[model samples]
Target: MSDVRKPWLPPRWFIRLAWSVHRGLYRFSGGRVGLWRPKPGKWGAMRLTTSGRRTGQPRSVILGYLEDGPNLVTMAMNGWGDGEPAWWLNLLAHPDASVQLAGGSHPVRARAAVDTERDRLWQRWREIDKDLDAYAALRSSPTAVVVLEPRAGQG
Candidate 1:
């Protein structure tokens, strides 16, 4: 059997330190956060908004995303313990969400890839970060590969 405990969220001090670093970098880059890219060909930070599954309130998160063809795919990187991140759960319940890409902000529909599609998408994700293979091994539940498609009139 594998450990299934929830992954520890970053400590408050760590979060504060990271925020300070990000802010300083943003200022140095003339308000652009491009300096924080984890890997080449990957967008730095994306502002994604999804409706709360139960509360119906709007929630936004700054997440790393990769463009796959005309769609954008984001991994639920809550370590290998947490099955899926809360933002992903919200998007799953309400596919109508919004995202801010490199160019601009726009609404999009979210869908969790299934089966072979999921495998292919995961492979692309691995290409971006080889370390993700470790996380992939720890997951007993399906890791969601979320696809964000541009909404009509916003292509």
Candidate 2:
């Protein structure tokens, strides 16, 4: 994919710095706040834990996500430009993962949404933020819309 076509956002140094501060504050607050607080506008944090594909070690990343019905959907943002994100690749290798949202943590299974599903969700996502169109355009491989479904009886 051409670098010029990629949907690279502005340098996220400030956002990362703020996220670090927020993470620390949440830790200090006994994990009560900051989990659902909006950063600016509609963006917020989503903590996802997945097992390492090769090492079987646990890894966690705080990402931005959007809720879609009973599923939690997250764009493979980096993936659009540079193939699938490592964590997402890990999830593909091991579908069992966990997501932390406003209410609580729940075991989830991750998979790339089907074509029809992607078309529908992409429309909804674009409605939320038009910037995603650029992201969708940059995909070297098809951009994956990951669906995180709650484990049976866990919802």
Candidate 3:
């Protein structure tokens, strides 16, 4: 939140570059090597395709997620940058989207987790990553915990 930078935090440019490389690798692999299912007490990667808020076109990204029963939870952390991620903004504009997992693809609707649910999910994340709070503090404000709920007819 402060202008003062933390010594341990990676620079914004490096973070953005790393994200680009990650996405590029996923795209280059044709999705075969990019995603996985979340195992107990751990996180996993998935491909989320959201409609572009402004253009109404598909935009996809690989994001880390934790399965919460029938729902998938991730953070709109923007690589822990100051602003919300574009995909999150897209979800806010158009809640309906699709996620590609190691098993298959399915429709999902996105929303921000709030109150006690958010606290619980955040605690879960802290269990997975001990530095969750430290990294989160690098942000100017609270990051929204995003929930991707399965749409009707899907388990």
Please provide, for model 3 over 5-56, each residue's C-alpha lDDT reduced to its tens digit, 9 standing for 90 to 100. Answer: 4537677899878878888887888877778888877899999999999999
Tens-digit lDDT track of model 2 for 59-112? 877776767768888777663455677788899899999877777888999988
Off by over 4 Å in 1: 1-31, 34-43, 153-155
Clashes of each: 0, 0, 0
Instruction: Name the top TM-score candidate.
Output: 3
Candidate 3: 10-residue stretch with minimal lDDT? 1-10
Q: Which pairs, if any, clash in model 2? A: none
lDDT scores for all predictions? 0.72, 0.74, 0.89
Among all windows of 10 consecutive residues in model 2, the one with the lowest summed lDDT is: 1-10
Estimated TM-score per prediction? 0.72, 0.76, 0.90
Q: With candidate 1 superimposed using the best TM-score fit, by how many Å does residue 66's alpha carbon deviate from the native?
A: 1.1
Q: What local lDDT does model 2 show for residue 68?
A: 71
Better of 2 and 3 by lDDT: 3
Candidate 3 — which pairs collide? none
Query: How does candidate 3 fare on TM-score?
Result: 0.90
Q: Which residue ranges in model 2 land beyond 4 Å of their true spot?
A: 1-8, 12-30, 37-44, 153-155
Ranking by TM-score: 3, 2, 1
